[model samples]
Target chain A: MITVNNLTKKYSGTTVLNIDSLEIPKGQSFGLVGNNGAGKTTFFSLLLDLIRPTTGAIENNQIKVSESEAWKPYTAAFIDESFLIGYLTPEEYFYFIGELRGQNKADVDSFLAPFEDFFNGEILGGKKYLRDLSKGNQKKAGIVASFIGNPEVIILDEPFANLDPTTQIRLKRLIKELADGNDVTILISSHDLMHVTEVCERVVVLDKGEMVKDIQTSTETLQELETYFTR
Target chain B: MLKQFISLQWKSFFRSASLSSNLFFKILTIFFALYLIAMFTLLGGGIYFILEEKVQKDPLLIINQFLIFYLFIDLVFKYMMQKMPVVNIKPLLYLPFSKSKIVHFSLWKTILSFFNFIHYFFFIPFAVVLIIEGYPPGHVIGWTMGALALIYCNNFINVFLNDVDAVFYSFLGALVILFGLHYYQIFDVTVYTAPIFDALFNQPYLVIIPILLMISMYILAFRYFKNILYLDGGLQQKQQEAKTESFDWLNRFGGISVFLKNDLKLIKRNKRSRTAVIMSLVFIFYGMLFFTGAVEAYEGPVWRIFAGLFVTGGFLFTFGQYVPSWDSSYYQLMMSQNIMYRDYLNAKWWLIVIATILTTLVASFYAYFGLEVYLAILVAAIYNVGVNSHMVLWGGAYVKTPIDLTSNKKAFGDKQAFNVKTLLLTIPKLLLPMALYAVGHYTIGPMLGYALVTLAGLLGFAFKEKVFDIIEKVYKTEKYKTIAAYKQKN
Candidate 1:
């Protein structure tokens, strides 16, 4: 479960994020959609306590995000490649993330096994560092590592951006399976309306840092998003 | 557990080794060249001993002094390459590892560096010569091992001291006290030189001092290692107090504020980038070690100009060359943004320019230990603003193998130097500046002629937009070449 109340953030006198009273029940998948500079990343940063909100608070699973240590064990996020230490090999990075969550190298390598075909051996290969990988592969590595511990909550930013279309479909399916099977709360921000529609139970739309819409995907069709963007 | 840590270290080491492997032959060639030079020095010293009735006053003290000064500069230079710091520290923190083990591993890593090989080449040969010429084996062994241990111990101490919160001022205060003592003729060896060198040359017991000092330094290094581990967290992240007016200087050149803000934000967001700036100042103490010789060498007009040039241009040339590429993987965010490339270039240029001007002024005063180097400083500043600016700016644009600012290891030559184009680019930038100096010296009387040429360069830099336009055209046309060049391992 997650609750955000009056979550506002600003940069240089410009309001990059302004939200008012949004809630998501446990085990639900929520998607964030908007044009560039929509404050999606800012909102994620605030919830993660990576950055402080100007005037707001977020509660994840009944624990205040800014003040609680409970948030650490319950949440994992990959907001960007900045979150990944590029000097590390993919396996080393995964083991590092896993160990932080009290898992061993066996668990990390096992988790990495499912992606061998998808990663094309590039992710775990010895010849290159994570930095030397293509953007898509690096995202795959970051995303898998973020999900490695199976935290109760996951937040991913622009997960589909560098991914190939086939991988995008696979990721959407994976996100849905993760939310439904593991009973996890997942929040994802993206520009792709179709992927968000297919994967999320509800979508929160932001424009210029303010929440413009919060609607269940079952209530609003994909055509409505096209109209919204064009308008 | 130590074995496991060593295994992890070997993994890290081989990763670097693989990068180095790309230049294995080149490294071997350089090694051989240095080996031959050492052999020559050994043979020359032997012939000198044979010719003279008595030893031509063992050059050991001069060599030791040079080694100390060299290592000090070498370590400071290593720290300036933004990537070297972050790369060095990252892995050790994650293992079921003690910070002490990690620091020990890092200290071991320091010896493995190519620069540290200088001790083996230069110092060992001299020691061997002394031993062959009938110095007691204990004296030779003790002195050689003691000196090498001290060199590495000093490097470890630098890394340890660097982690302390007030290290910058502590080091500065220490230097000020030492220099004050020197000026007051307190620490000067003239009073103690006879006894000290006498003990060093004749008595084997004096070697114990450096050996004990090195052992004590190793213990201190372990304590520093423990301190880093037990500290609350790795690199404390504190909220920056947002300031509105501090970035106003960029408003003069429209949209320059964006890149300025970005650069400032980077300096704030990443502790390592700020370390690059601080690391530049650490050289002040290192410079003081040879202050007298450096000043004495600058007594001539040519060497004076060089001292002024080096004192200022050295910092900029060494540290300023790799600009925003220091951002490494994080660079994509800025590149992806709608920001103009020129504005980004201008912000970095200005940062270097400001650093250069401040350094030139300080170095002038620092160069000759008097105001005498001030005129050379003035001329150097003009050249820096004019001629050197273009060189650095162009060098920055073409620079592909940007080291990760967060990584603390010096970029492996095999990683960054595989491309022949890097050589091509460096040749013109290095040669043109020297050619200009030579022409100025020959055409005009040294001081005024160089000053006038520098003035002309400054005028050219005043029209930097024109220079940038040319650079931009090349950057655009060579985008594919640049990408291809950078695509290699480096």
Candidate 2:
């Protein structure tokens, strides 16, 4: 569904990302694992066409991401708090995103019905603007918003970092359910090995903008990943 | 400890990434500050000469008579414009620093504020002149001290009252009531003003009244702020309720309306944007200065056109120029969304139109001045809705600097990117209507002049779709550059 061809991004002559070639087939749950300064966000930003790649191109569904706006219709991302409108309440934010994606207010309300427990009653109807919400709650709002339009391609950067243990478990289950033969391509970057192993069918390990390992997940994938990290 | 606090403030001022990144703005600001100091110094030097020659009464008495008015104006400005000095007290809270000491330091800093000293620029020379005019030097010193004490009194009162949201309305209400009573000749403040100040000046020892008042007000404000210095004090408790509200009626406009609703909430909730709205409302009365007989009986309708346009479209210049940058906080999300750029531009256009209409309605009361004034305002409002709205939106496309909504600074801090281009673009937007009015008046007649402006507006309204198309194209072309710029923390 997505193709990267000799894609490289640089800032001030220093390469931040230099993926020679990569592809994710349709309906795959792909995991990106990396530590700080691993170019995870830069990669995602390139895919979202937020920043230009110094060389080559990214194609979503055979359409060049930079050359066309076609991919925007089916792609949704929640990379950071910047993705959420700070002034709007969570509900208002959802309704706005839903409206942008051709869903009405009532439709969005219904779509958000299942995430009440995921929200922990701290988000919707909480009277606080998204900015005023705790960081974890703000992350939840952004994640929930990415799901509003039933987007074909979803990208989330460090979704589990700020979430509490309970919400992390819920999010893992939510990701698993959404990825189960739903024809939705999910790209998630996380440092937590256990959750990534549990949710993603395949994991790609990045080190300094270079993809080091492309491993298909199995029962022993978590142990293997842990071993790689310790080394 | 006070030295430590002052050093931290100095570091924060000079080392801020926003300030250091923009050398041009820093230099501009320095020059602006210098210009203000120079103007005040010049005013101080000239005030004594002006007052002595103009006033038939005792110059000191005349100065005292106007002192009350000056104090009133000073109080209003302090309440509106002065930001309370803030430090990151969180680190100090857990440290060995005493709360009273910290509060004292903060309050003491206000004494050295430029606002307090600017008054002396005018008063010092006046007092020196009084001394030279054979007035008792002690009496001159006493009255000057009294005036200075009153200024501090105002400063402390404002510091105490600033946090109470209702104080703004009450202050406005009191001013209106006082002016209304005086205007209707029901109560003459002037009748008492001379006697009261005369007594204070004659018996210079009575300066103790203002001195005492200043001390009490200082104590009151110091105590108030100290009580709220704790982490979970009234400051945190006063976090505005975050109730969710949907403008259901706006949903009829579909996706564009959502953007409008968000913009409305932005203006309502943010301090800077709220101030802009209030300022626009206050400036509706700016037309009163121009609607006088002198301007009306002047050779041309230029002043009328300027006043009308400003009154009606002032909000556009204040708020609209920053359009999408106002959403710079979330410009990335907005750009990534599955919405058309046209809808966003359309939403901004509609907002400007609504504001112009609302301001024009309020300013229609200027009809009390003259029917011609009212007609000029109507034409200008129409012109604003039609032409200037799109012009401001076009200006928005070039505003690459992101406005920090969370910053409590009076103006948006990122000034380097918003330099000459902004002024140059805005100049034509202001002057076009006036130019059209002049041409129509000079060539045809006054009635046709108004009609010509209205026709221009109608033409603009008619071609709005084309304008939106051009704006959308501009936005699309600049999208990547703008997003990258917004990503910078500075």
Candidate 3:
């Protein structure tokens, strides 16, 4: 569903990302694991067309991401707090995103019905603006907003980092359900090995902006990943 | 330790990210500050001559009588415009430094504030003139020292009162009552103003009263601030519950209306935007100042056109030019969504239109001045809604600066790029109505001039969609550059 050809990103005079070629087929739950400065965000930014690549291109459904606005209708991403409008309340934010995606307010309200436990009763109807929310709660709101549009392609960067253990478990289940027997392409980057192994069917390891290992999930996939990192 | 703190502050000013990111803006700000200082200094030096020529009285006695009024005005300005001295108190709090030392440092910092020295600009020259006029140097120095002391007294009092709830309104109320009583001759404030300062100049010992008052006020302000400096006490009191409001009627405009609703909330909740709205409202009275016999005697369209456009389009000029940058905090989110850029631009356009109409209606009260004033304002309002609205939106396309919504500072500062091109665009918008009115008045008739101005406005309104489309195209072309600019935290 997504193709990257000779994708490279340079800042100042230094190249930060240089992927020769890569592809994620339709309906795949792909995982990206990397250390600090691994160019994970740069890769996602390129795919979202938030930043232009220095060389080559990213294509979504055979349409060049930079050349057209077609991918934006189906793709939803929650990479950071920048993706959330800080002034609006969570409910107002959802309704706005819903309206943008051609969904009515009532439709959004109904879509949010299942995530009440996921939200922990702290987000909606809380008289505070999104800016005033705690960082973890802000992350929750952004993640929930990404899901409201029923997007075909989902991208989340470090979604598990700020969430508490209970919410993290709930999020893993949510991801599993979305990926199960569905043509929903999910791209997630996480530092936590256990969660990535549990949720993602295939994992790609990146070191210094280059893909090092592309491994299918097996019983020993977690052990192999752990050994590689420690070395 | 205090010297160390001062050096740290100097470093912080020069090394701030805002300075590094926009060096041009920083230099421009310094030049502006220097210009203001020079102007005030010149005003100070010329005050003695101005009083000698204009009032034709003992300039010293005249200045003494006006001294109380000056202090009152100075206090009001300080309360409104002065920012509290800020230091990185957080790092110092955990260190071995005593809390009293820190509080004293802060208080000492206020003594050197620019507001305090502004008074010296007027008083220093006045003092020198008094000495030259054969008054005892000792007495003149005493009165000048007394005046400076009172200025510091007001500065400290302002710091004490600003934290108290309802103080601004109370201070304004007190001023109004004092003015009203004096105006109607119910109370003669000058009766006291003249004698008290006359005694201070004659009896140098009377200066002790102001010095004592200054010390007491400083003590009071220091205790108040020190008490609140503790971490637990530093927490703001729980704010009043925010009422959830819905403008359900706006739903008729669909997605574009959602943006409008957000913009309304933005103005209501954010300090920077709220100040802009209040400033626009305050300017509604600007017509009263201009629509006088002076303007009537001048006899041209120049002043009338200025007063008219300002009265009608003040809010649009102040607030609308910021446009998309007002949403810069969440602009990336908006760009990535399935939203149309046209809807965003239209929302801003509608806001400017509504503001112009409202300001024009308020300024319509200037009809009390003359029928000509009323007619001119109506013509200007139509022109603003029709033509200036689009020009302001076009201006928005170039504003790359992002405003911090929560800053308490009244001035948004030189962060906004005010280039020659912007000035050129603004000059024509302001002048075109006058030109059209003049041509029509000279050739046809006065009434036809008003009609001609209105016709031009109507024509511009008729072609608004085409103008909006062109603005949208410009916005689309500059989208990436704008997004990148907004992403910079500085």
Candidate 4:
């Protein structure tokens, strides 16, 4: 339920991302993949309106993100450590975000109950702030907090990068469960081809901000992605 | 609820990384806060009697006559000492909460600043005095409220000015011109502003005039913040074309040059260090406060030496004490390198020396205070570069607090890379120099005083090799400890 039209972002005359047109239907699981300078983060940032677009607009649901802030209620994103306030405890952060989304502390506590196993009992009931947590635990907290407020759209950038192996596996299961016949729109960018392919039904490959491939995942999709990378 | 924002802010402040790290610092900060409140109360309470004794006129009329001047200076002090509450807005930007509410929350929190409360500490006591002195209670209350409204109006104006540099500069330029006109008797602004405050005291209800102005300024700041609340929105981002500049001129100095260049870059790029450098430079003119005054208390030898030491050595004391901790972000990388410890220490030493020299040279106008004062400044500068600079570096070994170069929380002392031990250590450093000067002046005359201080500096310079060796050993032992502290990011 996102439409990007004539989107281009340039830095000092160097065009980093120049998407002509792209659209994701409601309830779609979308994955983006690109190498370091391929503008995967840039595109996600533009979608989140974290940075202004050089030209054109992004429509979330039916409202233009730049023109109005109405779409913010249904949208949530965990782009990086900057998305987490460093001073707040994990539970406090969750409650803060939940409060912003019209949920009380009880609602947030209930929302967090299902992620106890995912947190491995390390994040909650702890005196340490989110900033003091290990990178993997920090990522877990950020990812779980995005799930609060029952958001319709969630954006995560490099979500699988710093996670430990067990957490990564659990996250994959979590994503698959959320996307299974769910109306939630999940958009994630990752360098891990296998995880993205398994979790996301449709994967888009970008090269230097240009959309190079949009493939529907299948039995052969893994081999095709491998070939594309090796080539 | 709107109250959640305040509670979250409270959590952010008390749970701040540094505040929780040391119990001593927390107590000291609270003590300092209470001390300031007590001082303000005394000043505000005493003003009524002081005015009564100085000029047989009514204190209210006297205050009203200078109210505009007071507000103008208050505006400058407010801008310098106060900061809008810093909220990490990225996480909050996309939340469902309205942008205006976030702006309003920040504005509401700004009212909690120590600067704002300090006004109440001043005004409330003075208002009590006014009522006790048989002034109409209603009129005194109205005058106090009116004055407070204008104070808050100044706060909002300062906020708006702080946001945009062009606006701030123009605002300052206008104020300077107005002040200059009054200073030279070219204009009498007191003739106009005195009546505005007079009306507030007379009618009691005319406080509404400033109340309206306060609301307008509040709305002005609110609209400005609301407009910029969108992520990546504010002013148009200017992305300059990237080009690498070479420091080849520094290449001739060998490995020391490399360290020097890095230190320079650290000061240039980091927010906290850069601000320190600017403040140290600004402090060089501190002599203006002590030397230019006509008051006899300021003419004492103690004040002269204190001001002289500050005029020359301020940079060495402030910036030198944090040399090692300034590189806290990359202390591990530095220790891991094959670079000699002497080079690291010498590079920092040289930077401090150069900074002291630069500050002293820029402040040479202190010569106008006469040759005696100029000689004291020269002696102090030499003492600074020699003895004080080395002491500061030695003090750095004891300072294990890691500064967050990225987040400039407040301008002074909050993230300063020194602990209470070194802070206490500075008292001896300050007093020893002053005592030496005072001893020489009182016992043997000013020339002997200069010679004594200058000789002490030369003595320190003569054996710097020993000093550097001792400091290097201290730093070597503390390097890993410092790295661990720096790794714990705030």
lDDT of 4 by residue, B109-197 (tens): 77777777788988999999999999999999999999999999988877766555467557657776887688679997888989888
lDDT scores of the candidates, listed in order: 0.62, 0.81, 0.80, 0.77
What CAPRI class is candidate 2? medium
**lDDT for each residue of candidate 4 in A1-231, tens digit (9 for 90 to 100):** 999999999989999998889999998889999899999988887776556789989999988876655777778888777676554567766765675566766898788998888999888887676656789998999898777787889898999999989999999999888888569999999999999999998999999989999998888888899999996
lDDT of 2 by residue, B51-132 (tens): 7787756667767766777888888777665555666566778888898988888788778766787788777877787788
Candidate 1 per-residue lDDT, tens place, B166-190, comes to: 6745654665565467577678533
- Evaluated against the true structure, the overall lDDT of model 4 is 0.77
Candidate 3 lDDT over residue span A65-123, tens digit each: 88888898999999998898766788888887887788888899999999999999999
Candidate 3 pairs with clashing backbones = none
Task: Give model 2's TM-score versus the native structure.
Answer: 0.88
User: DockQ order of candidates, best first?
Assistant: 2, 3, 1, 4
**Model 4 chain A weakest 10-residue run by lDDT:** A80-89
TM-score of chain A of 2: 0.98
Computed on C-alpha atoms, the DockQ of candidate 4 is: 0.02
Candidate number 3, chain A TM-score: 0.98
Off by over 4 Å in 1: A1-195, A198-231, B1-111, B114-116, B132-134, B176-186, B189-220, B223-246, B265-272, B275-300, B311-315, B357-375, B402-431, B455-459, B473-490
Q: After aligning candidate 1 to the native by TM-score, how far in Å is the CA of A216 from where it should be?
A: 15
Model 4 residue B367 lDDT score:
92
Tell me how each candidate scores on DockQ against the true complex.
0.04, 0.76, 0.54, 0.02
State every prediction's TM-score relative to the real structure: 0.56, 0.88, 0.87, 0.64
Q: What TM-score quantifies how close candidate 3 is to the native fold?
A: 0.87
